[model samples]
Target: MRSIAIRLQELDDDELEDFVDIWLHNRSALYYRTERLGKTSDKGRDVVGFVTDQLHEGDWDLYQCKRKTRGSKLGVGEALKELGKVFYHHLKGEYATLPRKYVFVSPRGITGPLQTLLLNKEKLRTALVDQWDETCRTGITRNEEVPLSNVIRTVIDAYDFTRITYLTGTLLAKETDAGPALSKVLNLVPDEAPEAEAPETVCEVEMVYLDQLREIYGETSGLAFTTINDVLAHPVHAGHLQLQRTRFFEAAAFDRFHRDNTAPGAMETFKKDIFHTVIEVYRESHPSRLDRVNAVMKHIGMTQVSLLGRMSRPPVRQGMCHHLATDGRLRWTR
Candidate 1:
């Protein structure tokens, strides 16, 4: 497995631009609607991300992508030229207002001189003003001297130059959220199960034992127990009622087991295996025909007690015993 950064570094210019678009979408979809601009008509922006408040009406951010080869860095002149486009467009009323942020996206990354300028807002502004004549002046205007107003200058001075930031290929490649985009770009199979937080709640089935007990008590006593308290108070059904109560607390542990085991139908298979294990325990007890139902119940409870050997959940054993007595093939008394 090649590292994501190393793989990203290998992408050509066109692919890198597309990958950055996807990366931004994955990374900031909650806060921004990412838009990719065409190469020639883009007017400088390779991608523009509008804040989620209301399309272009809200604040916006800009991205300029460069796919430079290894050892090549973004020059100061090139950086200045890109910055000029934002100021130039705002002056011409091409934008409603200047972007809240202006980011440079590149695989090769910015040169040392540009990186130093980016460290301090005042220094970066000074560098931009100094280089305006050579790099930005012509790019901002083709025909005549573009009048830069004092108001625009005040806005520029107040503008957060710190908003000018860089996104390196290494950072993009290492982002966990950007995995799908990177995999798409590299033409690799995506991970089937990326790590995610466990859900706060797990779905549950209605109490299986409670339903069975109601059926059993009705058959034995000519009336079904209408409430849980009635079932617990009934002398014949009291033990099984206690077992079902214990299972409610044990639900969280069972849910974790179900989630940890990834096999399909694993929960059903686990229940089936538990039933078989209980049956084996019952058969080994070998209660005699002379044994009454009460004696049989006691024999199973005592002799078959170890059926739950080393099990994490003790309440599960009680539920299994209830199942065996009521519904399982194992007869309480022959």
Candidate 2:
């Protein structure tokens, strides 16, 4: 919450408008457009969103942002003044229609008297009329003294006071849940618990050897070794295969950690290192099976087969390797 308050304090008018846009967008499905009126002639609104699902075809929700211009807190005078602009504009038809919701967003918040007035919907019109001369009448117009005319009074009286809403910096921060997407923009960590580690997506390492073992057994027994399933389904390897599944998940967790934290160019470097490790392990475990490694790499899309020497196969293709790493099937460090 402190982080959100600090972030709000740092935003200028443009940034605050954007913050409102993002916050509103994250919290609902209503599409939002910002600064519909140019910076100089916006009346009182900064961000506007449609209330219904049909995009621009619905009732409008106007969001007016009032940051602390020179004061420590936004007082009643300031709150009433901005609200007056909205009311004035709606009377003048600057807004095609009165907004269904008129929201005020500020870091300093509304003054205590105004806060109380806000709680009682029925009294808002009377309060605004009573305070209009000092708080809003002369303040709203620039050229001539636009006093609280009978027309303005009628508009204010007929206006729905229930449409008014206030959002302080702390309240907005508590309600907004865009998580890292928002946090990244603000350069702050999200106010949520860390996520649990996820397992990787690749196939198990031992499963890679199962086919070769089936071939060997078939050749020895003088039977057609068409599938590793036939050999591995035997009760003998069933326990060992189950153990290999555990290893696969362990490999997945390690890959997930690396992918989560790996910097941009570092992933390429890591892949190269893992490929070399795969080569070294394959050499140690299946020295005569370099052909198998070559086949595996080719199957995964390592197209530069000519690069493979008479002795060694190239590692898996970079894209495929990353995919495997992401899946948790490919682990280099056993």
Candidate 3:
């Protein structure tokens, strides 16, 4: 398979713009709305991120996308021209205020020299001012030259050049949160299942399943089981209770994780599959409630859950029983 950066470099200009819009929505929590300005006369903004309810009047960020061939990097001239457009247009009052950030989005990334200039905010500002007469001044408009006038220079001086940044396809691929968006746009597989180790401390959300287990233990062991400590004191039931809790929490984590990563209702539908698969076994008679629980677990091991693909591990499915039990859907003792 082609690497993510290589694949990104292959997308047409419109595709790249649309993807940056989607990717920004997924990756950033700051924006209330995002738009891809695809028209040629978009006044220098390719993608706009509206940060506040005031929309253009309040605060926004500008994303300028450049789709280069696989090996080529964005150079100082083009970078300065893009920066110039925003500043020149802002001077003409194209929008209410300058953007909170001006980002250069490219698949091939900026050249090493440009990267060094960006790292030093003062140097980048100097480069922008020095290069404006040739690159930005002419390129910002066909009709006239946008000189680096005193007014423009004052705005640039007060403005934080440090807000300028770059995002490459390589940096984007490293974001685990972007996995779903990448899969949707790039047709890549979703990232691998995240680790779901059960926490050592029991959480309040486990109360429902723990209650069921405690009551079931009382039925088999002939004890009152009023408190958790009482149950823990029992040599036999204590270990069993711990294992059940572990399974329940692990399954809970797995369900929460896949729900966020997979398609809508996927995890819910998978849980439903487990319930139907085990409802018959759960209805059968057993010597004790614990025996019934164990039987249902064994049944799920042999059965198949095709909904989640490789994500449906044995422990994850087994934990679904407690998922059902917590919602009053399945009860081992009842």
The positional error of residue 123 in candidate 3, measured at the CA in angstroms, is 3.8
Residue-level lDDT tens digits of model 1 in 1-334:
7776777777887788877677667657555688888476576678788886665567888878877777787878988878877777676667766777888887777788888888777898988776777877676656666444565566667778988988777777666666546645775433322222223232234344456555556556776677656766788677654544455335334534433322224434445555565554445543432223333335333433221122324444334444444444444442
Per-model TM-score on C-alpha atoms? 0.57, 0.58, 0.74
Model 3: per-residue Cα lDDT at residue 271: 82
Clashes of 2: 9
- Which 10 successive residues of model 2 have the least lDDT summed? 305-314
lDDT by residue for model 3 (1-334), tens = 7898778777778878877787667645879888888577888899999998887888999989988776788999989888888777887888888999988988778899999998999999999888888788778888987888998888888889989999888876676666545655676655555546556666788778778888888988888899766787799998877777767766877776665555445667788898999999999988888899989989997787755465466777788898899998997658
Q: Which stretches of candidate 1 lie over 4 Å from their true place?
A: 141-152, 189-334
The candidates, ranked best first by lDDT, are 3, 1, 2
Steric clash pairs (candidate 2): 200-252, 200-327, 200-328, 201-327, 201-328, 202-327, 202-328, 202-329, 252-328
The model with the greatest lDDT is 3
lDDT of 2 by residue, 26-143 (tens): 5455654433442777787778887655433457888888777644556677777777887788777776567788877776677777777777867767877888888897787685
Which candidate number would show the highest TM-score if scored against the true structure?
3
